[model samples]
Target: MSDTPSPLSRSFTEELWGGIASIFEAILAHPFIRGLTDGTLPEEAFRFYVIQDALYLRDYARALALAAAKAPQEQAIAMFCHHAAGAIEVERQLHESFFRDFGLTEQQVRATPVAPTNLAYTSYLLRVAYAEPFHELVGAVLPCYWIYQEVGTRLATRGSPNPLYRRWIETYGGEEFGRVVREVLQLTDRIAEALTPAQRAAAARHFVTTSRYEWMFWEMGWRMERWPV
Candidate 1:
């Protein structure tokens, strides 16, 4: 296989991305991401994020499995299934490494309560997975894939002084993750070609909403957000 990065589709999926240009810029400028670049973010905040992400990935994998089940084409089904398995693998390998570095056991991570934003984010995804059409589900999940790759690629340019943070950056910034995101983008374009105008609008709405949620997620980690109650 060629090692060159795949170009992202310039079709309807491109329009969806263009519509959110401002949101994407804001996400890149988010303090949590900036901190990742500078290595100034606190270990406590990182720990909270790691724990919450572990929680998020559990649901995210489920959502991907649902996507696989609902997929209209055999190729799409296989793709989603592969992604679902990849999600679980990331949780196991990446999080476990962080857990050891942070002196956290799996039991402690399990016992830790999911932060409010983390809960809200995953809940939205699961709701889409269970109830929404496949197109909308794909829209909802795209930001997590796309934004992380963008953030990681950008940060990997400067690189982090913190080894742990560098490792995190490498995961998303690597060519492997870029290839996966590009595949999803291509799938999104394929699905979009057949969408009704109304369906396109609804899918766009889901995409924007989840993109906003992606921003909130970083803030949640930065603040180490907790339940108000």
Candidate 2:
């Protein structure tokens, strides 16, 4: 047998990730993700996802800034602040490129109502950032960083014929983004070392909950989710 430990037998961060294996599998199986891999996704669905994502990033940046404020260490604070800036940069650059390609103007994207799942996901993160302990906030946000990296890395192997989708995969699958995710994972493990059993459980709960949201976000995009009256 290999020397590598199974996910369930691993330490904090790995254990947390392993516990949500089912959800991650579902996310990979999601139509939205599969379409990205095959480059068959409809333009309308992709447009809606990009718009919702741009809106989502603005609030996500805020939540990151809030996490920075709550961080106890200088390094942690700096990391969160940098991530916050990075999130905004992604919105401005990646999303903007997509917007232009889709013939969407900034005004139209801004005026577009936030999709229901998009709003709910961001609201959950912001609520955790404002109200939860720092460790829990980290748990809440980690899925976005970790899962995207996983998805990107996986899709990059298959590659899409569509240039735009290929660009999206490359962004997350690049070494720099992988390094960013690794840093956060390391930080999560370090934070876990100091947590009480109860605290660890709480953090795990948030991780699992946000993970479900991650899957839902894709499902929403697949459905081109809208707010119904």
Candidate 3:
């Protein structure tokens, strides 16, 4: 009898997501997300979130590129590149609209420093992208796509009275976004199929850690967090 560990007895997507349920619950329970979903989130708080998201996307685009460079398959390379560019372009368009509404100048947006949680989250993804195995890095990047898609879908279904909040929800929870999430999940599952039990465990750690960061990111925005110094 061959002992190859039976391909995890489940998909890595299920395992990783199952392992993070409490964290995901915490994220879903976070007031920031709730308020945004219901159209009650403070405008300033949402503004802070959008600005930080814009900054986060800049580095996130690079991280995705790094993942693309490390991809073992031609398909993965194309997928990552497409998502990377799409991520950047979507954020640029969203930010442009928000900037016009908020009277934010390009200079001002450029001058804004990355929030602590944003830096930590994006930096962790970058480090993983650069330093980990191709499959592991792919695991690392999955949550960013997965979590936002989840959040977007939930909020979108609830239907916000606030146009701004609804717009944010639509971008994430829309059919187009769902398609992107499905593509990433499929790719992650393909990569996970080859990982050993130990490797799967490691990948789970990355997933959970990043999931926590998603929680922290919303909390950071809610608090309008700044450097203590």
Which candidate tops lDDT?
Answer: 2
> 1-229, model 3: which lDDT tens digit per residue?
9867664577779888889899888988999999986777899998898899889988889989988999999999999999899878976898879888889987898799999999999999989988898877877788889999998988877978888888888988999989999999998888877878899888888888888898999999999999989
In terms of lDDT, model 3 sits at: 0.88
In model 3, what lDDT does residue 105 have? Answer: 86
Worst 10-residue stretch by lDDT in candidate 2? 5-14
**Whole-model Cα lDDT of every candidate shown, in order:** 0.90, 0.91, 0.88
User: Could you give me the TM-score of model 3 versus the true structure?
Assistant: 0.94
Which stretches of candidate 1 lie above 4 Å from their native place?
1-10
Residues 55-103 of candidate 2: C-alpha lDDT, one tens digit per residue: 9999999999999999999999999999999999954799999998999
Among residues 3 or more apart in sequence or in different chains, the pairs in candidate 2 whose N, CA or C atoms overlap within 3 Å are none
RMSD of each: 5.0, 1.8, 3.5
Regions more than 4 Å wrong, model 2: 1-9
